[model samples]
Target: MAKGKVGKTVGSLGDYLKEQRVGARLSLRQLADQAGVSNPYLSQIERGLRKPSAEVLQQIAKALRISAEQLYIRAGILSPDDGVGGSVELAILSDTGLTERQKQSLLDVYASFLALNAADGADDATPAGAENDAEGTAPITTEIDPDSDNRVTNEG
Candidate 1:
């Protein structure tokens, strides 16, 4: 790894690398050999003591048979734009049936939907004022009568 301004090593990136290596059933030495890095260096990376370069990460990704973009994301070198539709987005991008403009529109809409869902979840979390509420309301519950299946009852 060429020297760069090494900020704090990203813990998620280290964890991801370790997990991938283990999932592939590759020893630390084997991964280092395949990735053209040192065993000690790889060990440091896995332990979150060192941050590997993007090229090194790409090589590691290749050795693990995983997407380089995934490693880049874990390393915090790249932002995740695809969200849950990663493979779908890749397919859409490569599809010859759609024009570039059409593809762009589709991707934009998809990303917007993900963003909206995330925002909705954020709002669903405890609100600022509600966190200080001394009197809490009981959660509503609904149940069906076991004896008569058609009967419904609501309780709080």
Candidate 2:
């Protein structure tokens, strides 16, 4: 890829992280402290001037109460289709210190989590009733056919 494209992707990821931090009511110093990274280094990462390692990404995700895979996707280190479980498992398996048994255990746990989430989503999407259950609960339905570009219906 071109350098400009890479820079743009990095900048976009940085912007997203900054927005998330602000939304969580956290200051740069607070996030830095929580992530166990230097304020200047975190600032640099937030500005897209520095690329953080997977470990640093995990630390930031933990501090933000989010999945590190999500951060990895935003940073272009992983794709959205890879999913959190797969990406995290792959990252852990790549670590030099982890044994094969440990990697397998982690992968199994991640797979179970993904399966549970998928099952929950499937249950929600099933037609429980014609309308939503309650004020806070609603059924989500998407009509877009992935195989066809003409499936999109623009509601004016």
Candidate 3:
């Protein structure tokens, strides 16, 4: 069978790899260990100083716990749907070392942070209420139910 053509785009593969690595908050050494590749080699690949073979890409995808197709698409080796937006956050959450439960936990924390920030912003935008305590602080209490998912039960 004829070999498929690889992308000649400048730094496309390297950029993709680097982005994925950073998104996962992984160091070069960690990715190297997981991918069974040397740290120097992965570094060179991320710098566009080296080209990796298809077998190496497969290993990387396995280590990253993502589909080979996704890696191929990122590497410019395959074309996939461009309709769905790609998320660096999601890529990070997909790391092999992370369990589904851990990812959910991280997502829940992030959501709560966002909610708190939004609430603060809203308070700042509104006029001061007479109910403001002696410290002139708006009391917002977040209650978390152990049985429930990260949905906040507002005690306000």
**Stretches of candidate 3 exceeding 4 Å from the true structure:** 1-10, 80-156
Highest TM-score among the candidates is held by which one?
A: 2
| lDDT of prediction 1 | 0.74
> What TM-score would each prediction reach against the true structure?
0.48, 0.55, 0.43
Identify the leading candidate in terms of lDDT: 2
Query: Where does the lowest 10-residue lDDT sum fall in candidate 2?
Result: 127-136
lDDT (Cα, tens digit) per residue for candidate 1, span 1-156 = 423323333666888889999999999999999999999999989887887765677689889999877776676554476555377565655567877568667766876886887897787976535644546654455677889886565644
Regions of model 2 farther than 4 Å from truth = 83-156
Candidates 1 and 3 compared by TM-score, better number: 1
TM-score of 1: 0.48
Q: What lDDT is obtained when candidate 3 is compared to the true structure?
A: 0.67
Please give the lDDT score at residue 3 for candidate 2.
Answer: 79
> In model 3, what lDDT does residue 117 have?
75
| Per-residue error (Å), model 3, residue 122 | 61
Clashes in candidate 2: how many?
0
Model 2, span 108-127: residue lDDT tens: 68767778878877888754
Better of 2 and 3 by lDDT: 2
